[model samples]
Target chain A: MTGAPQDPADAEACPVAPTLWLRLEADGTYRVGLTTTAARRAGAIVHYRGPVAGRAYAAREPAASLESEKWVEHLALPLPGTVVEVNPLPTADPGLLNRDPEGAGWLCRVLAGPTDGRAAPPSVPTGAPE
Target chain B: MSLEPSDEARPGRLPSWRLLDLGRCAPARAQAFVEAVAVSVGEGRVPNTLVLAQPSAPYLSLGFHQSFHEELDPGFLERRRIPVLRRVEGGGTTYLDPDQWFFQLAYRDEGGGRGGPEDLKRFLRGPVAAARSLGLSAELRAPSDLVVGGRKVSGNAGGDWEGAHLVVGGFLLGADVRAMADALRLPHPALRPLLRGLVAREVTSWEEAVGVRPPWERFRQALASAIATEGRFEARTGAPTPAEEARFLEETLPRHSDPAWRELPPAPRRAGSLVRRLRIAGPHGLLVFRGSGEHLAAIVDGDRLVEAYRVGDGPTDALEELGEDGDGRAAVAELVASTPSFA
Candidate 1:
């Protein structure tokens, strides 16, 4: 169930929800962030409530809630894993999601589970990470 | 155009759509109907539709995530007998009545792949053009607001429901600014004049923006025509099916009327939570500061300070430098020290 590498130059993305990108780091953690398209669609994110560090969320379960002036959306990790770190930048200045969504606006980093690389499009479950 | 199948067919091989004009419905029914259409379109049971509705009675509509306790004055609402209902869409609280015309456009996701902002801009162009056709200069502002002469004439809210893209906005033909001010709980009692002034500066109605107020029916026809022409859809008049109406009665009505939905979830208590109120001397006049948690909001009389610069959310390095003791007076002093003196 590994996601096909869409871009050989960078991170692999879920075809269903191209807005979500997962990059596997050297330490076996997948750094996850919303693509610019997702960020723009969500509007200006004014608040972020988390996938707490050390907490493991199941696949399709909400990992974080992003609130904008006009909408609130729940974003889930494509693969279930223990959250290693959560970005503090968005909590301080939620505008970063719109200003620099792909870079500094990374939502959280999760320790890779056995099946962390699979594509879990927002529409369908790609099975929980082992 | 007649209701015949051939007449209903759209010209230019475009999709034909319905325009449901549910004129002057009860407050609860108005909310229910919009939700019904959104659900129907999302499920692909209904055609891409445009709905026009107006509440027969005055009521306060709360945005989906807004807390009723924090946003509205309950006593005022109770005394006035104005029912407060929470909408499924996200936006700030609004007071609605027959004087305003409400429009909602629901579309099946066509894979256009545009973001919310772009979608909103595209949806608004029709209304803006309709306003312009009436000889009023109107423009769409970012994040879904329609304005004339830089003052908002329409406020919009939108989101994806089920699988349908729903955008709802209202045009204020006439509004009671004073009643709107009294309905909301401002930070201080002394801020009423300030609120009125702010509203006067920011909001304009159709009658005020244009010289004459066209009849609501005329406005609706103009808007529908403009939208159909711009979006390339033939507008056919129709109503919700029996199943959709049943769904609204059984499901949407009860969910929106639930009392618990009006309140925000309780925030977790944190240790060392500082709540402070302090009065500081400002360049224009006395400024009152209310600081709590990581955010601070200030109130000041006069137009000297631009509205945007008056509020600060989350403490900055300057506030942290005041000391770890979290003294209210000390924080005020530190803030005043950094603020430039207005001579």
Candidate 2:
């Protein structure tokens, strides 16, 4: 979500639930973050927990939790992987997720284990990596 | 987070809504039951469902994101022996007792709303209709509120739970303004009366609006019918599936019982000076004020800078309109010193 190539371009494309994305890094690591729709629906981010750095998750398994003005729910990972690099900003100040969700607010970096990325939610858009 | 349903759904006909009327449950159980429903719906164990229930005792249910310390006065809660729990949904902090009848809805994504405007409409339509069914003129205040006249009759909040959408709100069958104020950690003593007056003025219930508290069975029947009609679902009396029941006892009840869980999510360490904004005498205006002893800054009618005596921990330059002389400014600040008002 933060610094990777993800999909679901804008707010209008998102609904109440978070529309998430998985961006594969050059080193084959992966990043997961929600789009603007989830951030906006969340209103101001009050608290956020980054995915655990070493926890392995099955594909589409929720990796973290967040609370906004709306509801508290887990942030699911679209790919099966072991969490590697946890973004520090949103962990310290959850508001970053609202301000720059697609950039600094990306949930975590994961070392992809398996799956061809077919497990992502149906509406996830494709993004060109920066 | 997953629960097994007692029965699988019929193959052909699907209910637009499944109704569960939990007439009276222990205070904590009443509040936590909805989480069970949400988990069931999210996991496909149950379809869209609506639940009606009331807590036998009084307690404070805070929003998921609300800071427990900032929103509550611990001394008061301890004195009253009231247990506080953080609800899964988000919104304002609320006080609940047996007199209040609550409504909760869990909708799966099959044909459900995606959140935002559509969700708000879906959230309040049934409650608004139920209020009207009782012969009160009720309408929705955007995002989530059921208002009658200009006062809010119901407090509501909605959001996604796993793969399902959940909305929880309630109508006060009685008014307890003083208790409501006493429970809050007021920023100032003066705001005490203001909050009392504000809650009494802005929040209304069946007892206050109608001559009598709405008869229990009658009101709930109307609620079920109205909710079913709004969603175009058939209303039928149903009990919680074994899974929902199991989770309520095994999970939610125990978690809410733990005192640490009540204060589990801490509030922010430092907060900016907050403004207390309350509706003024007129419907179109607001009185927004912020300050501490001897100094205050206020904005009346939204734009007028009525006074600028304080901001953060110290006094600032007073409004020039009152004159640059310290004497004149001090005189004005003292006149409205105790509370922010129009005159």
Q: Pick the candidate with the highest lDDT.
A: 2
What stretches of model 1 exceed 4 Å from their correct place? A2-18, A21-33, A40-43, A48-93, A96-130, B1-12, B111-115, B266-288, B291-304, B307-343
User: DockQ of each candidate's interface versus the true one?
Assistant: 0.17, 0.23
Taking the tens digit of each residue's C-alpha lDDT, what string does model 1 give over A1-130? 3444233124435743355777766666777887876776676675454566777666554466555646545466767778888886765566788898778987788885654554222221111111
Across residues B37-133, which tens digit of lDDT does each residue of candidate 1 receive? 7667756677778888888988888765455776786667878888788765666678887788888887766422232545677778889988898
Task: Name the lDDT of candidate 2.
Answer: 0.64
Docking verdict class for candidate 1 = incorrect
Instruction: Give one digit per residue, the lDDT tens place, for model 2 in B269-324.
Output: 43333344333222212232443443243334323334333323323333223344
- Candidate 1 Cα deviation (angstroms), residue A2: 4.8
